[model samples]
Target: MTATDPAMTALAHSWSALSLLHGRIEGSVERALQTEHRLSAREYSLLDVLSRQHDGEGGHLQMRQVADSVVLSQSATTRLVTRLEDRGLLSRYLCPTDRRGIYTDVTDDGLRLLEEARPTHNTALRKALDQAATEPVLAPLVRAVHQLQGDIPRPDDRP
Candidate 1:
């Protein structure tokens, strides 16, 4: 109730502002991924990982690994891969050495989608980073966040 109280003087806006910003990011990425590539955020994330696959002789990351990386259950991962395979956007090749194992490969169609998504994705990311880069007060917080690898999802096309 004091006239000089910091709570009254200073803005109480961060939580709302940050939430709005995050919502915009989620909406923007969702729109771009779906309209431009006919992909959901999760499906686009899966393709993004596979696009990082090297040597095109077909790179296969274990389904379980991908699921854990993206915070999805094994069954969900299986279903996601199944959907992509149905669309000819992905393929599952048996791991030659492990009969019980399989890996997902991004198909040519998946690569095409990635090509469509890359520039838009990069521009969004760079714009966000550019804002972060300007905040000297946030530098330590950003570094601390970067150091946190405790099962956190990497910033991808996923929400």
Candidate 2:
């Protein structure tokens, strides 16, 4: 495809904007998470999922379930879990019903860290959104992103 092609030009513009926006938002959140809680964004995501999965009593999620929720690859998820395990933030155990299945449970420390980091993460996100809203070219995309995020269902949404 030639650089002059309309379709190619449009695709390039869209991709470039997406890449830049992603980098900025991710970097801001990552920095906040790291500085405040010593957690990576992916780590925060894992903890958030684990916390939400908890039922009335203590609850746990299978390794595969976690891998599915996060953006990380399966191997990367496993490695992250191991790192959290080492830090005593979370624990891994075999599912009682399925001996081969590994389940991850967030420890009290993990929950505490998540709660502390929540404010920083939220602030970073709000700042990003506010910045995007001020940029005429990005405002529409920002709205579209929020709409899309709301449209996506969480695990509890399934029947």
For every candidate in turn, the CA RMSD to the true structure comes to: 8.7, 6.0
Candidate 1's C-alpha runs over 4 A off are 1-22, 54-59, 124-159
Kindly list the per-residue Cα lDDT of model 1 for residues 1-159, writing each as its tens digit. 787777765443444444545555556666766776677777877788776766445455666678876668989988998998999999877777778877678899888877788776655544554455456644443454447753234457486
Candidate 1 Cα deviation (angstroms), residue 92: 0.9
lDDT on C-alpha atoms for all candidate structures: 0.68, 0.82
Model 2 regions more than 4 Å off: 1-3, 55-60, 149-159
Best by TM-score: 2
> Model 2, 1-159: lDDT tens per residue?
786999998888888877777777888899989998899999999999988875444466666677989977789999999999999998887877779877888899999999999888888876776687687767777788878756333325575
Candidate closest to the true structure, highest lDDT:
2
In model 2, how large is the Cα lDDT of residue 118? 88
- Candidate 2: RMSD over Cα atoms? 6.0
lDDT of 2 at 10: 86
Determine which window of 10 residues in candidate 1 has minimal summed lDDT.
137-146
State the lDDT at 9 in candidate 2.
88
